[model samples]
Target chain A: PQNNKSVHCHHPCKNIHVFQKVAGIVIGKSDVKSFPDRKNIGVDRFTFSFTVKDSPDFFINVTAWGNDGYINLLSGSFSVGDCVVIENPLVATKDPEKGERFCPTTPSHYRLLVTEAHSQVYLCADIDTMDRLLPLIHLPVKDSRDFYSLGDIVANGQKLDGTVINVLAAVKSIGEPKQFTTSDRRKGQRLEVKLFDDSVSSLPLVCWDREAIQLVQTLIPKETVLFIADVKISFDSFRNSMAATVNSKTIITVNPDTREASLLFSYAKEASESGALDQDEKPEDAKTIINIVMFLDSITDVYTVTQLKEKAQENPEAFFGITYSFISKLDLDSSVSKVIRTRCTRCKLQVMEETQSCPNQLCPGRDQAFSASTGFDLLVDFTDHTGTVHGCALRSPMAEQALGCTTNEFTMLTDDQRTAMKWKFLLERCKIYVKILPSTKMRTGIRGVILACTRADPGEVKQHMSALLQRL
Target chain B: RQTQETLTKKPAVENSLRILTAVIDGMRHWSQFKDKVPYLFEIFATLDSAVTVGRHGAKNFLMRDGKEVVQCVFYENEQELPRLIRGQVHRCVGNYDRSTDVLVCVSVRPGLPSELRNAQEAVKACDAEMRVLVKSISEV
Candidate 1:
């Protein structure tokens, strides 16, 4: 207990007068941010960060600042993946409000500030030390197996929204890097890559870091399996879905020696061999989207339940087909939690928690008054006498329109009224337009996104069935 | 309901009960088999609003479309079932008591609702399915 005094401060934060040395490999380095002094008339201050990992479990961010000459010389002297040693760096508590978002997350509560004329950073000259440090680069910050599959992320919905998580998937496609200027006039670039596994068909992973984007550019899609650790998963309100982002804390391990990665590697190899990888790359022409609305009259390609099952096995990027379904009962008696999905208006990227503070670091309303949006986000399985298709994402505003009640209005119904209200449509012969994607064979299931669900006139169902039966 | 789970696993126990599809038109014909075997049946019908709750946890129900009607009684002592709304079609699976001609219920699943005029159309399909299912049970 007597030696525990420096536990909170470590060696760095307790006293600035003491001399200390830290050695590690430079795992990540950032570009410089040069800005004029707000109070001073002419002088400019330059700053940047380079993260160094000394041990397999420990890493710290070293933020440096000086005039343009000192900053450039220091940043240009070494590159990412280089081994470095710092002597007499000042350790201080991280800025509580901005630190978590601004810098990479570290186990320690403090970060080292490299000041001019006092601290020094030089490449580690010892071969023995460098040998031990460089191999740590292959290690992930989190366990490789501790990752969420693409389907698991979507299934969790907004509960996992704005939370950091590890992911295991193969790269489906990588988009060309696009350059832009931030509103603050700083230059920025983003490269988006689509990832997929057996469970989910497609998901987007966005990289804003120059280092990360560069590493991604060299990779071949479908041939590569990535075990991305500490990646931030967020609800993209823009797309009304979930997406992953590579951040400072994220460390991507490319095709590591792990059972999960090798299995995914094999899946990537098989999916590519069939040439099913690029099926989703080209967006179907505008006419296809419009057909979702004009489905009844315009679209004529109808599939039976068995036909839908066979098409999923073909592994298309996504296939659109019309099916006449009982869409009935929805196996109601589904627990209330699955029946109604509540999202924080402040978190999704939606609402906050019981406390005043929103847990989502990326939330726009993080510091504001808490508010929420609750709606029917159901996974209505479509079934007939033949087979069943599970978990078609039926979310609002489509859910509200199909249920014929506003989310707010639905909140007022009693348990009996809710059951009766739901029974109104669940017990109806329906015309359903769905977009299907193949799922992991682990669960012999397919994921369907219902584009439109309409209570079909029973006569229309009979007519369609008769037509389908004739073709069969 | 827990006591009847044997029907799900035992193949011989399953062979004796045919899940005959029924419509209101001629489901009365199924009563004749009630004295022969404790067979299962699935009937597509709608409930009348007038429900009578009896002592000993018994509840009485009517499944009818105008003149076509059948009586159903649910006797799950403690468990309360999901209340199905009136005029909505449901598939009720149960056994018929030979003495009373009452459908003693096990489970009810909400089904696709159609007009009473469509009831004849439903009967035509069910009659064909019933023949095939009944033939399978008799052969076994």
Candidate 2:
């Protein structure tokens, strides 16, 4: 702690000598400002606001002037959260005549000037202690001035004659980067990115030149939330929609340190994973159904119950297809009835037992078995060694195959024969494919629907048992 | 054309059967018994810990092997569960609950391993108790 010695520097104080050090967290930074000196040469000034360790509430503005390399290093290496100790800094009063006191717009009466003679800047490594003082460093809220939601910007109709606005949004989708010729005949790269806000409305953002290249390098759709500032808005006549164009001054921050950015990223991730964005608040279009079919077709791995439970936690609304062998049926309660029934083929409405007529009035045969189908609802408990879960095998083509005979044939059999059939077929060890749908209601667990079932071959089961014994 | 189709179909069917046989041959644990009949096997484990909830809720017990912990959920059915004293070795078997995040015992029988008599003697020397659920044994 050699440099831990405290020095007293306060308001109405004299300028400090060279080699004096001060430590603080960099709270704010201004864009590079250029000015012409007395020699008529262009000079670049970089200003940063910091809350000193000695007086946490008092901000001290630090201004540095240098060449491109020095300015770039100061801005690039240090960000808003960094704690730095500037060595050999000159504490100076602002010039009232030139209005330099208001140059950085900080509340402090005095400022620090860093020049070539005293430009030793040390970035501090002790962040844990500095984090405690972060509450003292106050940054003015700029959301009202700079930030605009897509819904608000659209409703305002400010882009009628092309207005530039700042927005904080998450990139929902991005097109492949492509090289294109600019209107000036120069070759440049451009890409189209779709940005969405909490309003659920989306707007197209076009990134050109260097920004497009940077976006291609760092942007991950549905994961990266960006803070895009000062983007030019233009109405596309052909599409009859508003779009944002990236220009040189547009400041693009990927995954910025902001609460809104984190919230937007999580929302985008959940919507994308659960397919909620497509299914919710939209008509049942062919495209939406096709997306679900594609997702179902893409599933190839057979997951155990433990894996399925974890998947349910990650995306609660998504359905997972699982294959398991039948272990046994749980003991039936009073609610479960061992009754055979007939149902309408089209609507699946049950028919009267005595008349064998469809109960549904819309059936083609008003009151006859000709328009109805026969099948039974079964709830069987299954296990794959990991856990036990109950699944409903609805009366479908797969259920009929599992039962070994058509529902109509089973309905015609005597009660004694039906009981024997249940023992021979339903109670036997077999493979069943089921689609497990997670319960939408909180804490209700998962529900499974059997899609297909097949009996286990005797020879294969024998071979499997032998191999399993060897492993044990 | 019909003969050529039948020749192609015959080889495809034979190839499928060969693949099915290979898949069956790879079966080891109860977790691998998807679409296949389950084989009864016993697990010799130390009952390291136990957690019991309300009267209606199932009791969760743990058996550990330093690296992995197999959780057993014991439900009170027609038969009552024998008191499980901790840190004692026991041999048990029942249906495996694969859907659970942890390894669970759908049912279990407490007994000495018929195959590993010497190991059972060692476990008995360590003061292991027989705490089988009677219903699980009866069902098997």
Give the candidate number with the greatest DockQ. 1
Total backbone collisions, model 2: 7
Local accuracy of candidate 2 as per-residue lDDT tens digits, A354-400: 54555555543342234554455666666533344655544444455
Model 1, range B1-140, lDDT digits (tens) per residue?
76589656433312222344456555677556454444455577788756678777777888875578888887763246557778777667677665786888766656655533343443454355445445655766
Error of 1 at B78 (Å): 54
DockQ of each: 0.06, 0.02
TM-score, per-candidate, Cα-based: 0.46, 0.31
Q: What is the lDDT of residue A381 in candidate 1?
A: 67
Which residue pairs in model 1 clash with each other? A198-A440, A344-A350, A344-A351, A345-A350, A345-A351, A346-A350, A346-A351, A347-A350, A347-A351
For residue A173, model 1's alpha carbon misses the true position, in angstroms, by: 3.2
Off by over 4 Å in 2: A1-63, A72-76, A79-82, A87-113, A129-147, A159-166, A173-193, A204-220, A226-263, A275-472, B1-140
Can you tell me which runs of candidate 1 are displaced by over 4 Å? A1-19, A35-42, A182-185, A237-241, A273-453, A456-472, B1-140
Docking class of 1: incorrect
lDDT per residue (tens digit) for residues A322-349 in model 1: 7866563453344656667667653452
Show the colliding residue pairs in model 2.
A305-B99, A385-B96, A386-B97, A386-B98, A387-B97, A387-B98, A387-B99
Overall local distance difference test of candidate 1: 0.67
Q: What is the DockQ of candidate 1?
A: 0.06
